[model samples]
Target: MEGHACPHEDILETMRKLLVAAALAGCALSPLTAYADAPGQSPAEKADPAAREISADQIEATVQFLADDLLQGRDTGSEYYDIAAAYVASRYRAMGLTPGVDGKWMQDITFRKASPAESTLAIVQDGKAKELELKTDFITGASFTDQLIDMSAPMVFVGQGIHSPENGIDDYAGLDVKGKVVVVVSGAPKGVPGDVAATLSRGKTKVASDMGAVGMISIRSKSAMESLPFEKLVGYIEGHAEKWVAPDGTVVVDAPNLKFSTYLSPEAAADLVDSSGHDLSALLDAYESEEEDAVRPTGFVIPGEVKVKAVSEWEEVTSANVVAVLPGSDPQLADQYVVMSAHLDHVGNHLWEAGEDEDGEPKDTIYNGALDNAAGVATMLEVARVIAENPTAPRRPILFVALTGEEKGLLGSEYMAKYWVREDGEPVGVVNFDMPVLLYDMDDVVGFGAENSTMGETLAAAGAATGIGVTPDFLPDENLFVRSDHYSFVKEGVPALFLMSGVENGGKEAFTNFLKTDYHGPGDDLSQPLNWESARKFALLNYEIVKLTANADARPMWYEGNYFGDKFDPEGPRAPAPAEAAE
Candidate 1:
């Protein structure tokens, strides 16, 4: 303690420091002290729940049935999807768990599908207005904004929309974005991880709003178009019905600050940039041209207001979120709830099978998202069952949620995070299970958002219980943190973690291959190789985490200087960690 100074060193780092002292004292390293969670130790041992109640057979059976093609990929708006919900509800009723939402197992989530009836992007050239075609030139969208958006704001193009001071990069440097609409590309620099870059892109909206900007315009650059083919990109955003989150229903707080936002086509973006005397192609080339300078400041400032008007038509539809509760045993701790969540929806069936394989056979049309989420849901059900069936309940209540419309941009989880409240009403933490591809044995788990709070420690302890290790996010650039249900909770000022079967033990290869060979395709069915034993371990690990977070005498707190906590929960970093935890 006298020699160490850093308070944030992990267990291994602390050990390394200790080793230095041991050599000074001329002592051999004690094996007992070497292990963080020894076989038998006070406060450092595994709180392994009797996981005998968790059955591998049941897990496999549940996964097989849910991911089966007969369910028609369990699309969110289809009858098959409703059938899946009913099945989950039935299981909740049978498990003796109480309804989490009011007095019912279902939390009715209403969604408004918005489609642009008419969209126009016009510019005042020499005080004369010119209109740009809707789909051909640009695709203006406002699923959350009013049915109509009319704005004549100035424009600024930010590279990757990054503004991290630590990274020595600021796309909006030396510019004022107040009362302006900032245009940005759809991606980050090449070296930046997709998750981190995407997260930076998300922060760009907030940065602009804080800077007093009115709106945003995202133009898919040439690099973006090449990275994701034009046809595939258009197909994704071309759907008439975009799941629109209500102002009060969304986890994205910055979306409301924007008056209008749209995606401009390459030709359309070129037209806008030409007025600034900068070639759109040259700007894109700058991003790819220099490796060290992943992104360079596009110093071109285009003058004049480009009026954006979007008129949309919407239809309301309803979906159900299956929620159940295992009431805590301890009265004091029962007030706080630990939520365990997983999405129940998938991409559903393909419109039609157009692609062909090497053998000239038609590609599988139905998107049986076995690993994408059905596996996650099945594991959630198993964890719930095991915990509820236990003789002794945890001190804090455990809320289990099977969300809807996750494929539609995490709609249900965002809805619940905004509306759902614990019976006694105290925030604790969240654990989200998304796609846990268990093709082989996994010794570690990658937590997407665990660094924000004590959820990181909880995951470590839970991993120790099952001889599994916890690793930091390896794909931070993918923006994996905000891509799932847990992020919805995070935005509401809750510390949360998104767990995935890690990329250890050839998991890198296994997971990568699974993505290429099966992900969202019909191949994500029963025929896909799944490790039932791995699934069992994962469920057990989930159980241990629930017990750890729910039964601990103390509430989970945000770690000091967590990047996410500082942004979402401002007051969190102000609190000091325990002195004993310091180096």
Candidate 2:
């Protein structure tokens, strides 16, 4: 990564060189013309070809505006986020789509910002007391209440605190934690399949809640605690704003009061656990041993009560999903809908001061998320314009949605999927555009969670049509499938696809390198070289796939055997298909 201290002159010079290179490469590629319907054609046949076309200029324009520093990285709950939202809404209105739900394009979501008002911890060994600083020495909180807890409830250390029926392991089996504070290790028991981390994290919270624990505090592993800081830890907490679901197939409340917290400093944690007579090294060894199915808690039960008073204030801020609709020509077919979406939010400015960049210069720049999502949002807008200009609408309604708060954990999309309903109350099929363009060259398009629905085949056909092959995600073990906005829709039983360019054939090094250095840092910027032409091509291909899915007579179905497929009933009552559902 380049130093952030590049002078203004250097910035200007670099941009000039790139622009000249682009110009030399020949800037005027012919606009992809729409294919005309046959003569004496039915209303469907007379549909505009413009619906499938996207312009390079439009893509550049949207990307430029959204990635501009003035928007301050489009951070959720920041003024910059509002700017991005307003811009998207304006463009949608200009494209001639109706406002969503209440004749307004914006959907308001409420968020709570919370932190501990006061916290105190004590270590008692040999009948002696040692006090710890609240933030520096310990971190704790609960989701169940914002009120102060002033009880010295006994603490029981549970190793990994996992209870997986599928694995035939039950860590909580004979233990009762009712009204007690349970201390658990942060990660899964060692030797568990590497892929089990995600499932464990999701399920562990539920188990803790069901166990009736007053509070759950996860001690970070030694390595994790050494590397992370309170700021980043707190930042992650702020980012976990997604909607959760209960096992019974109900949408749990947005921001449910499930008190879960962690500490990032090893030194702080060592102070809390050292007083126990059991050796820390031995305990960790047992926690990490693969042979131990019955990993016992360290048995260092603390008798002193701890109290936590946390106050979270709700800030009512207005944010929007930029929406534009292309209505179908046939009244009956138009009722069904296909929606395309991308997130426009990113991890904005770093709150703490961290000194200067590499050039010995002061550094306080914002974390501009150019490629992380500005690029994706730009792609969606260009596709919208191209499809709108096309001569005819497809058989079903097409909706273009630019979502907000994705970096804050898919909050925007989750809210829409769980709460937004049509006038007659049916949900729409969502096709999400997330992290699509890659700096590396591609051999195929990778579809995350593609097997969940027949949309995978539609994506394959579109890729084939464009000479871009389709491939299932090569790194399913990473669980990339559930890491994006598409998961929210899939959880709601809405068939969706998350697309990405394939890894360069040379090796996996490129993907890892980019993520390590460029993925979320200041290094991600428009000034960096990007293959815009490939991005434009991707937009065009996506338009075609959406068109096909919308126009198909049979709605896309989830593939059997997939977890999501088995969970949702495709034949169940659907919200009234919007006029655009057919196309």
Candidate 3:
């Protein structure tokens, strides 16, 4: 029989002792090894019916095709991505899944893309203007509602510019930033909850706009400088910014009240606060200090009028999200859906600055996102195939979605999460697969958002049945709970869970190496040593989760007083934690 433990000599000896002990005591043994292939059925497949239909070879084939160089990285709204979407749709049809969107297998989304053409930023003080060089002091600026920006306004510094009553934080407690440019440091304070801090970091722009600020200039904090250096940040922002267009032909700008927004280097940020009676270095020291009592910078006015002008090149592009459904057998529970999703897009090739190989031939700039998302889509597809082929349909209908524009801030999922619901059926929960990093024989899995809803219990049950350990998020600083396609569903008040390979059984080293070496780079191709066994295990785990959720008597609900639950679904049904519920 295949064993559950890795095949190291030391582990094998340990497992042998455990098995002997269990047999002597007449205790029933757990399933045999993870790779058991006993007589046309593995032990895992026997325990999990859905696992029988999932083929690791099929997952590999799907990833090989989607992450090929010919696909040009599957950028959203591009022809290459359209081909990928069509491929997913074709797979759904072949699996005998009905269309999810009113007989249509796709949801079309239009987006307005804006790329920076040129910009000029200057600080006018003492009747003299000091112009900042682009790409040196300031990166770029964009305004979704305007093609050109020309304004000069007084500048105000509001520290981090956060305003969360729940967190007892109000950076703008007494500041009036009306008609002024708000200068603030990026990210939240260290003591805030990781998930809540992530939300506050993104809410700065909206806070500034709501306070009648004309523009916003972000200065990277010490943490940002260490995690995402200025050069790396520039590389990320050099491309075009995209916003989905609504059905009414209007683009939804979150901070529509603001006309311009840009980021500044730390050096440039220090220069702006040179004569403002506050030492930038001292303020930053306190802001990032680890002491028990560290004072944060408060709001203050800068001694300058910041004049910034920008020109944007705008274009309209379209993309589609592939959707499919497997209806349930139970008429009552079938009215609700359990959603399984993965993004179908990646950062496209940077064609403008394409380089050359040793032979002077054009170099490979295609990002061929093998692990960033192509593998995630492949895993979701295998799960869908297994569920669709099950002899008895689940009690609740299952909706399989291949979302688009995930690399562009989860646009596709956002649209569907907000507006794709039907009067007859609603999505009760989401299980998203994104960048599972299946490069090692994983021993455990990390369940993001597991603690926020009843899905935590479902995840626990699924893990136990699959002989996989469930672990907490080891890298909470990454704020992964709010960083994937599943967050879109969470924002719309649906309970969601994102499971990824955890940092155990050599996973930490492998995952860290991947982030440093290949994440978001051309090196993320198929040349890497990816573990097919790990991929199969992950797919089987998710399949088991779906089976449990779809067949459960009651729909998943938010745990009472959870931050995300209260914030997004204030009036939705709430329950005690799973452990408490049993009591």
Candidate 4:
């Protein structure tokens, strides 16, 4: 929708031709076939009487409503987020699901917001000092307290400040930067496996934090500095805007205080180091050759200083989570809960940037995050509808949760998992749906974070029931396990499973291409082709699996040696065996 215009005329013509062709062939149309039935018979015939039937119309309606422009982008703490939350809650109410955990449908959370304001960094070199802007020049070192960080402290040059005992490397083994500002090269340690960019981006702050330095200044290499463009800068500003402002008109926290952290022009960093009477190139060469950790504390310390004044404004606002419950048929099992979750938030509207509509006025661009997560939330709503219509309730209570702020570090799930307690004080296992729509037919469904529990076997068997195979992640290094809400449950010692379509048999290539080109971008719209049939199959498969687990004689437990396996111990893998071995 952002780049290519939809060929509405062409699509209409194609549909008309197909209809005419079907009429000429005297083909009898069946809703079941149009929805998701196996070959040779209508879906109604093949479907188990106990299985809840979901229609394609429901999926379409849900997607349309969630992705509608009126909802904006559903960014957390924004007006759009509140609207989306209300929509989800209303859908749950219409489906006849009672409130879960509490009498209310919302679980509130607290968070701290911070931003950089009026930051100045100056280096006194040869008695001449120059100041740098906050973001354009540098960020801050990690510090939880507010203090005037004077540049008069000694400066230690640590090359690629990394200290990983697991990797047998410690960049700061002999350096003492206590009360001193440390300067380090930004990048990953040499020979680190995986994408250097991703690793460095996520690991740099932690690495600096672990070094116990007063403050850190990162020198960006020429190539790295050159890679920063206007688009990336604007995206960063837009995405982080909410994190700097609270919904209420109160500043939760001041900006962080550390030494001046910034990317200096290669020449600027070199000049500063050289002006301090140190051979910058030689120092780098020696550090590179040493292999082990190396630190060169130049006797000449440049007294760097910084002043920061950050102000945050907020407005009082409120949002909610959608909670619904399906009571179990078995009175005893009804108390145990099986939770299905998906976030209902997305990045919201973007202010106009020199753009005008056909009417010759500035136009606002709404993110309309259809695939980023709206589709997943829509699928959850449809699932709730189907399950509510089932002939008999599941053996165990099923809770449907449409969470918020998933983009904001899974905050909604974290709050619910941490605070929402059962009547008996037991935590609930979560099965979260995220990005369930697939670009093409999937022969296998990939399960992420399955190693943490025996739910992997259940998931595999569930897929097998729908004639779909189960596969482990082909790209585990991507860390899909920790990327979704399921990780929150696993962290709390609750067994959880996350599902994705398998990459085997070409699905991998398709999925990879989608991730690279479409993920999190405006291009991720509903108009993009998706295999609805496969989605339906996936929903039904999960329904069966959740139903079986809910009705099980015992609660689901973690497998031996699993990530959360220790929590269910004494009662090991066999405590609650699988309903059946996966084919």
Candidate 5:
């Protein structure tokens, strides 16, 4: 048996081998050899009764329907998404599953989509306004909010707009940005931890907003532009920008207080800062150059104010987190909920611009999100159906949530975790299903963040029950833990498990190709080679884990003083088992 706490790297290597070996031993029809008949395999290994009961046919039906072109990729704030929601809700009713909230399976979420209407901004210097090109010199802004604003505010250069009192760093010190526009370089200086820097940089706008700054313009540091090209950033901002709304009906985002926010192209950023007593190139070198710790505040405000005119319209859009509940058998522990979750939304489709392919045919328009999520949603619906049909209920209620706006920014899960109540009680744990990419009929399952909580033990039990070995995340550098819907539950101090198919047995090549070629693109459709049986087996594995969690003698809890538990809820930690605690 594994301990409650496992070191990430050691356990990752150990489990990788265990997972690949067991998978090769015939965890299913496909192993390392890709659907070959391996020797010394049990009948259960070839075809699981539970998996067979779940039925690949049913899984295919749901995936096909959800990933179809008619749904238009299930974009967050679109009419097509409404139709998809209706379909999921209809399935819940047909299965006789109880609603998770208010006799309605749908939980309303508010969102904001900001688009540039008539965008024009310039630098005011020496009684002459130097106008900037929209996409060339700069790009019109989206994000934070949608509104028309005309402001003549002074530009103050703050290193990265960071003010960390915990660390002895304050770029705002000896600088006043009240009612002014602050120009900041994108990203943080060296020596700051990546996650911490990201947290600070993300919250920088709030600091600026609180400082009474009316607006901000971000210059792409060379490192930033190198990481993500200017053209890609432009594509992001040009689209319909969305963020989740709070109870107050306002967009609940990082930079709510600012009247405007914009990102400047590197060339234009240099042009704007020229001859302003501060050199952009020199400032960038101070931070990113060989002198790692030499970066600090440069108390130089540009000589003149900036003239910005942003024209945009605003509209209130709504989406939902589909919720259904299955009650537990035990009266004492049933109130503690085990959430079976997945995101129902995808990037949807980019608008059909008039264009032609090399063959002189119309280009691909719809983004059919087959593996990106519809698979997970279909898996969720199947689990709900099987549980509802079964007579024996688990000890804890299962909250089946198909979230919206995950592609937009995990907005649906964020709202659900903070607001949704399971029979007026909190969640005991979360099992998130996402991007299964079950293209290879393979061996091994991967669990992200399972080591941080009791979910690790539950995952071991699940693998044992399903005859599939579990491994730690193979790609820890990708930050998979924070990239999905499970993160919201983690932020709330709830223990979580994010199940993924491992990349072994040629699965790595398949996964890489899928991510590079099909992920978020129109090609992620039914036309792609999908392993329906493997998807069914994945549902079985998830079902086993979630069931173990639901029927556990004690609810799942974060390991003692872990990063998330220590940071988000210092008071909450799962009590160790008597035997384990005595070790």
Candidate 6:
């Protein structure tokens, strides 16, 4: 016993000296630092003892600073966003974490922002051309490159335009859409799983492009309209699309084959399909129906040809993703990483003069994304602090990432998922915190993408430890599972979970109200009343999850027969279904 001094004693002694030095220097001590002041605590008691004692004041302070008007919404590729990235780096330095991005605190990615300069669409029927009006009938979009598009092709009707053979439903099955423009109804059938549906819905353009389609025309069903109306879509007609560029200055194009793409209003779509023997209204209704056996159309050749053209303008910009790491105590498992991520960027200022509105009153144009994502970054930082400050480190390294360009269509996260490689190893699992609206005291949390992987069990354990319940998605139609930065990691075969403030104990009302009033708008600022207690609990829950994941014996795996696992990560390890996982 004389020769076997405990390892943690040395760390404790060092911490005590640091605390004394900090006290003498008049520097503020964190909650974990204050907790460590106790004497004679055993090594077992010192390990992650403050995981549940996350400080609400610290979380609020981070949020207040990030969401302040001085930051100017932290828009990606802007000087203000660079300032935010530097702040996050400073926080990582304060926590004593090493830089995760190849000895740098940030990974600066080059991106190309492209918007349509001139776009035109026309419907050709009975050998006659009818030029449709832009911004009224359809709007060209999703083209990330500066290109000239002039294509006149035959039209095909691909019901949902989803090509997921693993899901046993490919809208393109038995269809000859090669070199043709395909008209697609937005939203998947009600029978499809939520996560699958969300991914598939977004993948329509990529599928069309891959299938050699020359052009794409999108129309929304009633259900899709209920979620995202055409009017709301029109607001985004003048695009601000951004895509990461390679080192060679080549812009990334997800749907390259598609020279033209447009989303039609319901009226325009109805008119296009009226003479094709298929009633658009009936098909939309069938797609939205809840009946077990409903009429869902497969692909068909519509009796029409379409002509479209587009010209785009482009500019290049650079943005950074702030990254830090807490090295593992166990050298054997230290190479593998457990990643915790939250987006650091938000939509920029609105189109308006700050000094006056149309009515001669002061206007607020800055989109201060307080609850949209400043809160999420704050929560991630709090978790990082707790984990980094713990006396005992997890067996596996933990990566803390504050990603930029999330507002620009997940460009930052997509870049990281595709290009950011660690010399040690790949990430074992990812926990993404995005837009946890903590407007009220919540009793539960929604774990998106949980059912698809083994992380569900970790989430349950973490929620239980933090005195919160695991709740199902209350607003399923929103397709939130695929909306955030986590989906980018998922696309790269990483098992990930996205946590959202649940719709329980007035949470539904609060979340709904926030979305209606403040989401992506100038209203998401510090003036709103936020429940700091809930923010503390949310941070604690995510920290517990991160700790459990990093310390687990086996890496997180996709459930056997899971659609996402089978489709995206076919070769990764597999686990039993969640119902049988424990056994």
TM-score of each: 0.81, 0.78, 0.90, 0.71, 0.82, 0.90
Sequence-dependent TM-score of model 5: 0.82
TM match of model 2 to true structure: 0.78
Encode model 3's per-residue lDDT on 314-409: one tens digit a residue.
899999889999999899897889999999999988676476668976666778899989889989988887788777789999999999999989
Q: lDDT by residue for model 4 over 349-392, one digit each (tens)?
A: 66544376698755546667776687677667666766776666
Residue-pair clashes, model 3: 3
C-alpha displacement of 28 in model 2, angstroms? 16
lDDT of 2: 0.63
lDDT of 2 at 525: 72
- Please give, for residues 248-333, the per-residue lDDT of candidate 1 as tens digits: 66424465577767777788788888787777787777776647735485544577778987787777677878889988888877
Q: Point out the higher-scoring one by TM-score: 1 or 6.
A: 6
Error of 6 at 554 (Å): 1.2
The prediction achieving the highest lDDT against the true structure is 3
Mind sharing the TM-score for model 3?
0.90
Better of 4 and 6 by lDDT: 6
- State residue 298's C-alpha deviation in candidate 5, in Å: 6.2
After the best TM-score superposition of candidate 3, give how far the Cα of residue 89 lies from its true spot, in angstroms: 0.9
After the best TM-score superposition of candidate 2, give how far the Cα of residue 228 lies from its true spot, in angstroms: 4.7
Cα lDDT, model 3, residue 330: 95
